[model samples]
Target: MLELRGLGKRYTVHDREVVALADVDLVLKPGSFTVVVGRSGCGKSTLLRLLAGLTLPTTGAIHHNGGRPKVGCVFQEPRLMPWLTVAGNVGFGLVGKVTKAEIEARVEAALALVGLSDFRNAYPDQLSGGMASRVGLARALVLEPELLLLDEPFAALDAFTRRGLQGELTDIWLARRPTVVFVTHDVEEAVLLADEVLHMDGGRIIGRREVPLPRPRDATDREFVALRRAILDDLSGRAGSSPPPA
Candidate 1:
């Protein structure tokens, strides 16, 4: 489990203090998939960065409940190395510390998990947008991380590709059961992917909505629509009513 208490981050822009996150208190369970949704600059990405240890908080602390856990992070872009092939990028993290056999095995397993086995030798420039994003996912999964943080990884793709990748991501999460915090601004995407959806605004968490719906959710379903409506309402500052609890 991971816990955040009074977590805050602030940065100075031209000597002017700008607050990014403010007093966030959250608890993330092992194998739980939580998605944070908010407008850009609402501090969604900042929270993920704090969790991934890419940045230090100006206040409060992140508790791992014990020792530090292995963390993997994928940003909005694929960010693959231009010179590395699919397999090479996937195994980048394991290159020096692990042996050849171990790296190959882990890399192969990750590619299989992401359904990119056929593209092992393909370079980044050769991959389509959707395929490149999958390679990014494979790179993260290769570490077999205890915690995975993804920030709008599929936001750029077309609708068809986005939905397909969303399904694949859900499958990966279900199979590996990694503690995941995926950040996105898309309400429907959040509804489709998360076990629990968190709403953030102005650098603070506003509400929490749990999606108890079963796998392979249908957006056209009444329940799913209601859930999305509740999130939209909350985001708009009119949370007087919400979808009935699942």
Candidate 2:
């Protein structure tokens, strides 16, 4: 289990203190998936960065059941090396840290998990946006991290590709059972992927909603639509709003 206590972050922007995240208290169970949804600049990215240890928090503390767990992070962009092949990029971080044979085995498995095994030798320029995203995911998964953080990794893809990748991500999460914290602006996407949806506004988590639906959830299902609509309304300060459209 991982626990965050009174978590907060502040930045000195033009000599004025800016609070990006404030007093966030959360507990993440091992193998559970949580999605954070909010409007732009609602501290969603900041929270993920703090979890990834990319930045230090200004207040509070994070506690892990064991010592700090290995963490993997995927950003909005793939950030792949233009000169490296897909396999090379996936194993880039393991160079000199693990044996070459071990790196190859792990990279191969990660690519297979992301369905990108056939593109092992493809360069970044040769792949489409969705494929590049998969490579990014493969890079993170190669570490077999205990905690995974994604910051709108699919936000730039086309709608069709985005939906496909969303399903693929759910499959990966189910198979690996890594504790995941995914941040996004899409309420529907949150509803589709999260075991629990955290609503953030003005740098604070305002609400939490459990999604008890089964896997392979249907977006058109009444319950699914209703939950999505309700989350949207709550985020928009329209709680108890009208029912979802028929």
Candidate 3:
């Protein structure tokens, strides 16, 4: 569904050039959920922005097959309008394209999908942090996006809230099945949410690991333990942390 060939990005600030990404190549298949995991300043978010066309690569190309795919992005914050109600925020993206009736229907459906149907009329300030984040997700889902780009969308929530939203997100993905490229610094969250994990470092992809474990994954399982260790080693810049499962 998405392809990046020789992808690279660089910025010039005050006459000094900084490379954010370099010679990176990746392919994303239709409906696949892939997570890019790396420490801060590792270019993970830059990659997502490139895919989202929010920024252009300095030295490479991103190609989507045939027709341009619809995209929805969820940033670290809810980014909802302070004055807009929940339904208003979710339907905000549909303006000019969809009819008022269609927009209302989409907003209501997305709200229900994210377990926020009861709070449809609540304002952003009235909602808790987690509830506000769900509003962000609902706004994205209302677009019926073919590709969903999430940049640590749950990083700010409390642990329990994060976990709850993670499960909710998984169920939503399983049902809607959008092509997802999620970027996160949390290894466990990436492992639990993605079908494949890509470890990035120094503006390049260092490793690709497939998570074979079943959904509703057990965090305490032995296999999960091994995988976690391997990912930790990779992020820590260890050499050949562990061989890929044979």
- The total of clashing pairs for model 1 equals 0
**How well is each residue in 47-141 modelled by candidate 2, as lDDT tens digits?**
99999998999999999988998998898999999999999999988899899999999999999988999999999999999999999998998
**Which 10 consecutive residues of model 3 have the lowest summed lDDT?**
237-246
Off by over 4 Å in 1: 243-246
Instruction: Please provide, for model 3 over 150-223, each residue's C-alpha lDDT reduced to its tens digit, 9 standing for 90 to 100.
Output: 99999999999999999999999999899999999999998888899998888999788998889988778899
Q: How many times do residue backbones clash in model 3?
A: 0
State TM-scores per candidate: 0.96, 0.96, 0.96
Q: What is the C-alpha RMSD of each candidate to the true structure, in Å?
A: 1.7, 3.1, 1.4
Q: How does model 1 score by TM-score?
A: 0.96
What ranges in model 2 sit over 4 Å off? 241-246
Q: What is the lDDT of residue 144 in candidate 1?
A: 86
Give a tens-digit lDDT track for model 1, residues 113-222.
88889999999999999999999998898888899999999999999999999999999899889999999999999999999999898899878899988989999989
Tell me how far the alpha carbon of residue 13 in candidate 1 is from the true structure, in angstroms, after superposition: 0.5
Task: Report the C-alpha displacement of residue 2, candidate 3, in angstroms.
Answer: 1.0
- Flag the better candidate by lDDT, 1 or 3: 1
